[model samples]
Target: MGKSQKQRAIRRHNPMRVPDTHLPKGLASASSSSSKNEAVLPIIQKMESPEVGERKWACVAVSNIIQNDPSTRRLLQGKNVVGALIARLTDSEEEVVVEAMGSLRNLCIDGGYDICAEMYNKNILTPLKAFVPKISTTLEQYLANPKAAPENAAKLVYEFADNVITTLWCLSETSNKALNAINALQLVPFLMSFLACRDRLPLAPVTAAAQCLYVLSDDNEPAIDEVRSNGEFITSLLAIARTVSDARTSHGKVDIRRLQLGVLASGVLKNISPLPLAVASDIDIDKELVTMLLPVLQNTSLRDATARVPVLLSEQANEVAVDKPSLKNTPKSDHRSPVEIELESIENQLRTTQLALEILTAACATLPDPDVSKHDEEADEQEDEGMEEEEIDEGVNDEMSVEGVPSKDEVKSSVDLLPSLVPVLIQLAEPTALSFPPLANPSIHPPTTSALGAVHIAALECLNNIFLSLARNPSSTVQADTVAAKGIWDGLWKSLGLVGTEFGLGQERRKQFWELAIGVLWGVSMVWKGFLAPDAQEVELLKLFCNSSEDERVRVKCIGTLECLAQCPTAVDGNKIIAEYLFTLLPTDTTPPAGVEPAIQAGSALIDIYSDETFPYDVNFRANGYLERLVAHVDAMKKLVKGIDRRKPGGRELRLRGEEVRDNLVAFLKYRKALKL
Candidate 1:
C-alpha cells in the first residue's frame, strides 16, 4: 500500500441500491428524451387529483415508470413530483398513502442524492413519523394472529409496514438532516421487533427493518446509541447472518431466500461493525462476530476460479462485465421471469460472498479517528518518536498492544483472526487465471467464471490492509520484511514469506502474493542481486499479471505495484521481462486520457525504469523499439503533466512527479549518448 491507500473508510453496500422487489414494474419506463415531452407532468398533475383512485393509480404509475429510470426520476422531480408524492402520503385512504410511500422510496433510490435532499426539503418525514408507531402496533397484532392485521388494514399489513419503514430508511441514508427526525421515532426497539419476527413474517418486511437499523447505526451517534441500548436486536441479527441453513424446499433445492435473508442480516452487522452489539455484558461483539464469519470465508464451493487464454488473444473469449451489476443491464421483468431469477440468484451469490469479505475487511479496518484533531501534529510526532525509542531501548520489541488494546493499524479481533484470514484472502485474491502469451494491447476484461469481479477485488483490498496492519506491528509474527542485505543474501523474500515460510505460495498464489508483497518491501534498504534477478516463477507471474486481461481495474493494481517497485531505488531491478510488460500496458496508437490515474501510474513507472543507471533492456534500447517507446511515453507524460490542474489537492505533487520522471529520463538518455554504448 502506498501513502495514498494506507487508510480507507470501510465500504458499505450502498443503501440507495433499493431492492424494490414488490414495487411496480413492467410499465413503459419513460425514456430520457421524454423529458422534452413533459411526460411525468401529466402523472404529477393526476397525483394531485381529488378522487383517491386517480391519485393512487398515478402514484403506482409513477413508481412503475421510474423504478429503474433515472431520466424519468429527474423529469418527475422537475415536475414537482416529490411534492405531489408527499401530498399522497397524507391521503385519506391508507392504500393510497402506502403506494405513495413506495413511489417516494423508489424516487429516493432512482433519483440519487439530489432527489433525496429534495424529498427532505418537502418535509416527507413529517408523515413518515406516524407510520413507525402504527407499524409497531400492526406488527404485534399480526404476529399474534398472522391474518388478523391484514383483514383489519384491508391490505397486507406487512407490505404497508415495509414500505413505510424502508422509505424512511432510504430518506435517512441520503440526507443528514433527516437523521434527527428518524432518531426521534425511537425506532430501534420497534425495528428489532420486526427482525425477531423474521421466521413468521415475510422476508421483505424483515429485510426492511434490518436495513432501517443498518442506516441508523452507521456512523450516526444517536442511532448507534439506540442500537447499543437494544442489545438482543444486534445479537439476533448476527446469529441469522452467521447461520448457514440446510433447509431444502419442496423441489429439493437449497432455501435460497433464507440464505439471502442471511446476506441482508449480515449486511446490517457489516454496516455497523466495530460497534459492539453483544447483549451479554461479558461478551465481546468483535471477537464473537469474527468467530461467526470465519466459516463463511472457508466455504471453498463459493470460489469457482477460472483459467483461460488471455481474452485479447483468444477467439472464444467473450466480453464479461468490467463492473458487473450495471443498472442498464438489470433484469427488466416486473415478475420473477427466468432471466430475472437467474440474474438475481447470481447477483445474490456474489453479494453474499462480497458481504462476507467486506465484513472481514471492515472488522480489520482499525482506521484512525478522522475527526481526532489534525492540529495536534507535534503531539503525534512526539508519540512516534517515543514509540521508536521504546522499540529500540528494549532491544526486543514492545508488545503489539498498549493496555491490552491493539494499534491504529489493526482491529484487535482482526489481528486474532489473521492466521485464518491470510490463507482465505490469498486464495480469493487470484484473478481469472489468464493464460498469457503477453499481448501488446492494453489489458481487457475477460470472462471470469463466476462473475462478481468485485468479490476478488474486495478480497485484495482487505488483504492489503491486513498486510499493512501486521507488518507495522513489531510484535506481529506475520513476516512482512527482509533485512537489508543479509536477509536478501541468505534467501530472497524468506523473511516476508512471499518465497517461503508460514504463508507459502503456490504457482498462482506466488504471483498474487508477489503483487501484494511490494508494500512489505517498501522501506527495506537493500542493494542486492536478489532484487535484480527475480526467480523464473516470480518474473513469469509479473508477466502474466501485467498482460492479464482479467479486469482493467485489477490490472491497474499490478501497474500500481510496479510503480511502487520503480519508486524505490533499492527495489528497482534490471528485469527485462518486467520492462516489456510495463510497456505493453501503455498505449502507442492513442494519446491516453489525460485525467486517468492508470495512465499516470504506467507513465511514472516507465520514467523510473529508464531513469536509473540499470536499464531493464539497455542492450536492445534501439533494436527492440525501447527508444521509440520511451520518447513517445515521455511526450504523453509531458502532455498529461501540463494538462493537470495544479491548483487542486495533490495536483501539484502529481505534476511535479511527472516533471521529475521526464527530467530523469532525459538525463539518462544524455548519459547513454555520452557513453556511446
Candidate 2:
C-alpha cells in the first residue's frame, strides 16, 4: 500500500493499536500470526533501513505479529523486534514514528506483561520523552489552523496522539517504574486538553486520552491529586459519561458509538467519583448528577448487539451491522458524513455495561431503605428526563461544560429499584449465547465472549452485593426471609454453577463467584438439599469435581460449597436431608464406583456421610455389605493413582489427589472395615 493508503488503513481499522480496550485473547488468528514470523530477522533488518517505507513496513509487520498470535507475542519477546521498534520512535520520518509507536504500543498490550518489563528494561520512555512533545507541538499547530494544513494532516496528529497516549497507558498498567516516568512527563494536562473542548477534536484521540487518563489516575496519588484539582475536567468527564457523543448513525438510528463514548467517559468518572475530601466542595451538582446518571444503572438495554454492529469492530467504520431486522427498513441518515463517525467497539460496549453494574453495586451499598415500596411517577419522570438530550450540535456545545459534580442527597426512589434491576441483572449474570459475532474458527466461544464473560461476572457481583445488602438492611424493601428470595434463588441456582463451569472466564473469577455463592447461599442450601446435593440421574458438583477442564481451586470451591452447607446451622431437617442425599451417591452392595470419576465421586460422598453430625448411624448400613463397598472405593482410588504419568501438565496434581482420596478412605477403617457403626 502507498503511504496515504496505509495511513487510512491505520485510521479505518485500528484494531491492536488502541491501548486499554484490548479484547481478551485478541481478534487475530494464532495461525495467521505464526505464519508471519518466518520473516522476523528480515523485518528487523528493514527496521534499521535508511528508507522510510522499509522501516514503516517493518514496524507494521511486527504490529501484525503482536495482534494476531499470542504465541508469536511470546516468541518475539526475546528477539530484537522490540529494540528495533524502540529505535524508530525518533525516526526523522513522521510515518515511521507512528508505525514504530504503534508496534511498541501493541507489544505492551496483547504481547503481555513480560513485554512491558522488557520495554521498560530497554528504556522505552527515553525516546518517548522526546516523541511526546513532537506530537504535542504538531497537534496544537493543527488545532490552530486545521484548514491551512493539507488533507489527512489533522488525522495524522490525532493518530499520533492516540498511539502515544495508549502506549504511555499500557506501560503504566504493567510497571510502576513506567508510571513514575510518565508522571514526570506531566502528560495529564495534555490528556485533559482533549477533554474540555472535544468538539474540534476527533473522537479517536479523545477516547484514547479518556481511556489513558482513567488508567493512569488509578491508585496514583499524584495523578489523582492532579485530576481532583481540575473540577471542570472532572465535571466534563461526568457529563460526557452521562450523555451520548452523537445521536444518530448514518442510517439515522441511535448510534451505538454514541453509547460507547458515554461508557468510556463514565469509566473515567467511575475511577474518580465519590470524590476525595480536598476537592469535595469544589463541584456542587453531585446529587443532581447522580440522579441523571442513575438511569444507566437501571438500563440493561445498553448491551452490545453484534448483529447491530460489526462482528469485528475494526471493520465497523466501513460497515454498519445491518443484521438486525429492525435496522433493515430504517433509511440511512444522510445528515452526517461518513467522516464524522468515530470508531467504537463491542469490547467497549461490554466494558461499559460492566462498569455501570459495578457502579450500581457500590451505590446500592450506600443506599438507605426505599422511602416508598414501589417506583412512582416522580422517580420515573426524573429517570426519563434526566439524561435524554434533544441534541448538542456535533460537539460539547457548552452543555457539556458543567462546573462541578458537587454533592447533595440522592433520589431515594419512591418505588423499589430491585424489581426492575434484578431481572436484568439475572439475565446479565447468566452465560450469553449471542449469534452474530460467530465463534472463532476453532475456538468454541465467540470473538466477544471474554468481554461478555466480564459483563456476566460484573452482574453476578452486583447481584451478590444486593443479596447481602438487602438481607441486613432494616429499612430495605428487598426481604431476604430465611433464604434468598424465591425469585432470586430460582433465577440463579443453575446459572451460578454454569458460571463457574465456563472455560473462557479466568479461574480466579470463577473461584470468586463460587466463594460468593457459599457466603450468600449456604444457609439456603443447608435448608434445601436440592441446591447443593447431586440428584439420582445427574450430579453437577460431582461431575465438576472430576472434569479435568476445571481448575483445582475452582473444583475445591465447588466442593467447598457442599462442605460448608453440611456444617451450616439450619433447621433440624436440613442435616437429615443432606445425609439422605449423600447416602444415595455412595457405593452400595450392588453398585461399586464404575470408574475413576465414579470412584472420586463415591469418596467425596463417603466423607460427607461419615462427617455428617445428624447422619442416621444405622447398624443396617454396615450389615448391607458396607465393608465390601468401602474396599471397592479404596481399590478404585489405588488404580486411579497408579494410572498417573507424573511428567505431564496436571498429572502430578491428579496423582496427589488420588492418593489423598485413597488415604481418606483407609482412615474410615474404624467404622468401615470393622463394621463397628
Candidate 3:
C-alpha cells in the first residue's frame, strides 16, 4: 500500500470520535471567514476524506458531531465504520490506536446492555486489550509531567471499563484479552480501595476511582463468579498478607508494612466468604488473617492504617475471628495512648487509629439488633391465628437502620475486646488544644510553620468524619453520648473561624489546605444532617460559616452548606443573603474564567440552589432579583455544562445539576411577574 493509502486505511478503520465544539475550520480560516459554519464545512470535508490524515481528522470531526447530535452515534455502530475502527487498533500506528479508542468510547457512551453485549460480541474489546497497556504506560509517564494527553488517556480507559461493567459479563472468546481485562480490574480496584481507605488522596484519583469502581463493581453474577473461580488467586491474597508481619519483624519501616496489611485487609473485606471459598480450599475460619493483621496495629505508626484496615477486615471476619486478638495484647511496655497527648503526636501517630475507631463503631452500630423478642411456645392460639394469614414474602432492609443498630451490650463487648482508640479521636477534636490554621502571612506568627497548618487542617477533617459518624448513630453508652456532640460542635466552630490562613509557606499549599478545610466542614454539615438536630446552635454555626472574610473556596462551601440547611425545616431564615453572595461569584455582564470547569460547576450548583422548587423557602420571600442576576449568568452556566459533557462525554454529564438550576429559574420567573424581565 502507498503511504497515502495506508493513512487512509488507518483513519477509516479507527473507531474514535472527534469532539463537536471545535470551530470546524482551522483558526486561520475561522478568522478570515464571516460565517463559523462555512469555516466548519471545510473541516468536515477534510475529515470525511478517504486520505490517511483526512480520515483521522474525519474521526475527530465525527466525535465532535456526536456530542451535539445524539442521532449520528448509530452510524459508528454500522459495519462499514466499526469494522474499519477495529482494524485500525492493530494498525501499528499509535495515533490510529488513540483515535480508535476515542471512537469506541463515543459509540459505547450511555449504550444499553444489548449495545454493550453487541460491542463485546463484535470483538470491540480486543482493540481495548491491546490499547490500554499502551495507554497506561503512556499515562504513567505523562502524569509525572502533568499534561492534557495522559488525562485524556485515563478518561478513555475509564469509559471502556464502564461499558463492560454495565453490560452482562461474558468471557470474550479472545482468551488473552479476557485475561488482560481481569488484570485491568486490578487498577480500578486499587484506585477504589485507595479512595475507600482514605479521603486525603488528591481529587483526580478520587474522581477517576469512583467512576471506575462504579463501572467495575456493578452487581453482575457472571463476572463475580468468573473472577472468583480462578483458583487460589483469592487465597493467595490472604496468604500474602502474612508477609507484612515478616517485613515488620525484619525491621522494615512499619508504615510500608502497615499499608500492605491495610490493602490486604480491604481486599478481603471487598471479597467475602462465598467469593473466597469459590477460589481457595481448606481456609480455616478460626485462623483467619485478621488475627495476624491485628498485631500490626500495636505500633503507634500503624494507627490510621490500622483504623481503615479493620473496617474492611471486620466485614471479612466472623464473630470468633474478630475478637480473638485484642489491642491489650500489644506489649505492656507500650503505654495506653490518651486524649491529652499533644496535637502533633496525635497527628503523627494516632490519627489513623482515631479513624479506625470510628469505622469499628460504625460497623458495630450498623450490625443487626439481636433477635430479642422471641417466639413463645405458650402462644399456641396466636400461632394458629398467624398461620391463617402467613405472607411468605418478608424482605429485610439491606442497610441497618439507627433503630435497629446493635444494642449497647453487643457494641461494648465487641469493641472492648479490641484496642481502645476512642480517646485519641476525642483528643484530636478536643477544645483544649485549639489546633487552628496559621495566619495569612505566617512570618507574622514565626513560631508556627506550614506543616503545622496542614496538620491542623487534617485534624479538622478527621474530627468532621468522626462527628458525622457519631451524629449518624449516637453511641448508647452514657459517657459517649454526653461528650461526642459537644466536642464535635466546638471544633467545627473553631475551624470555621480560622478561615483565612496560609499552609506550607507557599501559595499553592495554602490554597490546597484551605480548600481541604472547607471540604471537611462542608462534609460535616451535610453528611451528619440526618442524625443531627437543626437547633439554634446549628443555626449559629451556619451563620458563622457563611460569614466569610476571605478564602473564596471557604465561601463557596458555606454557600452549599447554607443551601442545604435552608431546606431544613428549622432553618432560621430561608432567603437570607445567600442569593447576593452567590451572585458575586458568578461572572457578571463581565467574562468569567475562560475555561475553568471547576469554577463553572461551582457557579451552576449555587444557581441550582436558588431555583430548586423543592428548596424550602417562603413563597413570599425573594432575594433582590435573584432570578434576574442568575439570568445574566446563564451564558456561563451553559458554557460550563457543555465543557463538562465534552470533557467527560461517556462519563456523567454536569447537566444533571445544571438542568435543575434552569428548571427552577424558569418556574420562579413564571411565578413572579416582575422578576421575569
Candidate 4:
C-alpha cells in the first residue's frame, strides 16, 4: 500500500478517539453543551466504569475541566465527583490514582469551606490516612537500598507522597476536623520525617510537608505540643528559614519558593510553645529566627507603603484644587500600578513579620519572672560586700550588683534583635500620609488610617517583652546610644501621644493602645532609672489623657503610667501631677465608683514617692500644696466611708478602697511630719 493509504487506514482505526457516532442523540446535540454540568456528566459516569482505561481518561478529563474552568468545580462536587475520585485513590493503576488525587486537589483549591466540609464528610481522610503508611514503607525500603531502587520507582514514591500532602494541606486550610484527624493519625512525625529526610527531596514535597505542619499546628494545642517536643523538627524548620532568608538576601530578589519556606517555618515556630528550661540554650534558635525575620519585617514594599502618598494624589501632581469633588472629576488613574500592587499583595513578608513577633512573644513568656525576694537578698549581699571592699570603685560595685536584671548572656540574647525591630515597629505603628503636599484641602484626602494595627499590636507586645527582659536583668544594660539611635523611647512616646489624640479610634482599641503604651513605659522605667521621669512631655501627656479622656479604661491606663512615673525621684513634676489628680478624685461628692480605682492608684503612687528618702520632700510636697490636699483627702475619705452600706454589692468594696487611700495618705502625712517639712 502507498504511505498515504497506510496513514488513512491508521487514522480510521485509532483507538484513542471515540467516534461521536456512538453518542446518545441527546448528547450528540450541540444544545447539550450549554451547561457544563450536563456536558460533563457522561465523562464523570465513565469515572466509575469497569474498564481501567475508561476510568483513567475520566479522571484526567475531570481534572482538566476543573482546572480550566473553576465554575465547574461546584457542579462536579454536586455530581459526587469527589466520592468517585476518592474511591480511585486505592486504584491499582498508578496513573489513575495520580489523576484522581490531582483532580480532588484542584476542586479544593478555590473551593470554599463548604467544599472542604463536603469532602471531609465523604471519608476522604480515611483513604488519605491509609495512603501514608504505604508511602512510608516504600520510602523506608528505598532508603534501605537507594542504589538498588529504580530511580523511577523512587520518583513515583515522592510524587505520590507530594500529592497526598498537598491535598491534605488544602483540606486543612478550611477544616479543623481534617487537621485534627490528620494530626491524630501521627502525621506530624511522618511529615517532620520528610522535612528531615536525608535524601535531597524536591522543594515541592518539603514545602508541602512544612505547610501541612503549619496548618495542623494552628489552634491545635496537642499538635503544637507535639511539634515543640520534637527539638530536631524545630531545629530543622529554623535551619530552613535561615537558609531561605539568607539566600534571598544574597540574591537581592524575592524568590516565592524561599518566601513560602520562610513563612511556613516561621508560622510553625509561632505555633510551638516555648522551649523547655532544660533546653533554654536553644534560645539561640529563636535569635537566629529573629535575625532571619528582620529583613522581611523591613521589606522595601512596606517602607514604600509608609513613605508614599496615595496613588491618586501622586498621579495628579499638577492639579492644585484638593477638594473631593474636583478630584472626582479628574481622570481616573490606577494610582498603584500593577507591579506596585503585586508587591503590596505579596503578603508573605507581612506574615513573616507577624509570625516573628509571635515567636518572640513566646520566647519572652518562657523567661523566669523577676525574683523580687532574690533581688533584695542580692542587694543586701552587695551592701555587705561593698562595705568590706570600701576602697573598691563604687561604679564597679554598682555594675556588678545591679539587681533585677537577668544574667548577661540571657539579657544579651533577648534584646539582640531589639535594635533592628524597634524602628520597623515604629514605622508600622504610624499612619501613612495621604497626600504628598500634605493635603492642603483636607477633604480630598483625610488622614489615612494604617491597616497594620495587628502588626502594631504585635510589635508593641514584643517590645514589652524586650523591656521586661531588660528590666529583670539589671546586669544587662540597654545602651543610651542604642535607644537614641533607634529612637526607641522617642517612638514609644510619640505613639502614646498619637493614640491619646486619636478620637476616631474605637473605645476598646484606644484602651488597648493606652495599656500597651503604659506597659512599655513601666518596662522601660524599671530598666532605665529616670527614663520616664525626665520626659516631661510624656508625663504631661499621661496626665492630659487621664483628665480629659471619657473612656474609663484609658483613664485607668494613664493613671497606671502616672504611678510608674511617680516612682522616679527625678520626676518631681510627675509626682505633683499624680498627687493633684488623686486630691481631685478624693472629694466625696465628685468621686464616682469608677473614680475610686485611679484615686487609689494615685494615693499608692504618692506613698511610693514619699517613701523614697531621696525624693525632694520639701520642694515637691510641702511647697506644692500636696501635703494639705492629702490631709483633706484623708478627712473626706473618712466621711465618705461612713455613708456606705457594707452589705451592698459594691459598697463594701468602695469603702475598703476609700479606707486604703486614707491609710496611704495618713502614712504619707506621718512621713512628711517626721521629716519636719
Give each model a TM-score. 0.59, 0.61, 0.36, 0.56
The TM-score between candidate 3 and the true structure equals: 0.36
Alpha-carbon lDDT of model 3: 0.40
lDDT of 2 by residue, 1-677 (tens): 00011111111112232222223443244335455556566677788898777777777777655554565665565466788888888789988888788788777656545577688888888987777777778777877987886777776777777887777777776566777878888887888888775778877778778777866665566777787788777767767766653435778554445565566565555556667555455653333334543455444443444344333344544656443222113222224333223223445556566656655554444333222212332332353345332331223223222222212232232115555676677777665443212223322223355556556666666655554443333323333332435555556666664654433422444544544453334323433332343332223453344344334333333343454344434322443444444444444434333433334544665565455324444332444554565665455456665565544554433444555566677776554544444
Please write out the lDDT profile of model 3 over residues 1-677, one tens digit for every residue. Answer: 00011011111111112212212334344334332233234434443455666555544444554442323444333324445555655655555455655555555442223234465556765555554355455435545555555665556544543433322122221133443454444544343333443332333333333333322332323444444655543444454444445644355554542443343333333333344655545654322433443443344332342234334334444333422322223211212223212222333333333223222323333243323122322232253345321331122111111234444454444434323333343333332212232334222111122223333433444444433333344444422343443444455555444443433333443444445444545544454442333445545554454443244445556555554444443342444444444455555444443223334434654544445444445331344555556566666555554434312432122333444454555555566545442
Q: TM-score rank, highest first?
A: 2, 1, 4, 3
For model 3, the superposed segments whose C-alpha errors exceed 4 Å read 1-489, 493-500, 504-511, 528-558, 565-575, 593-620, 631-652, 671-677
Per lDDT, the best of the predicted structures is 4
Per-candidate clashes come to 0, 8, 22, 5
RMSD of 3: 22.1
Error of 3 at 15 (Å): 41
lDDT of 4 by residue, 1-677 (tens): 00011011111111111012212234234233334655467767888898887787777666555532334555666577778888898898887887788767666654545566688888898888888899888887887788988997787778778878877876665545565676678778888888787236766677778877876776577778887787688778766766655645456777655566766777676566455545445465555566666666676344464444355446555555433221113222225454344434343344445555555565554344323344434443464444332343345434333434346676777666566776776666543332111112222321222123344556677667776676666534464644543366677777655554544323344455665666666666656654555456766776766776665545655665566666666666656766666555554555554465555655666666566656563367667767666776676565655455434544434444555566667877887778775
Model 4 vs. true fold: TM: 0.56
Clashing pairs in 4: 404-472, 405-472, 405-473, 405-474, 406-473
Give me the runs in candidate 2 sitting further than 4 Å from their true place: 1-33, 244-256, 276-344, 361-417, 434-441, 444-446, 471-476, 480-484, 497-574, 577-677
Per-candidate RMSD, Å: 12.6, 17.1, 22.1, 17.8
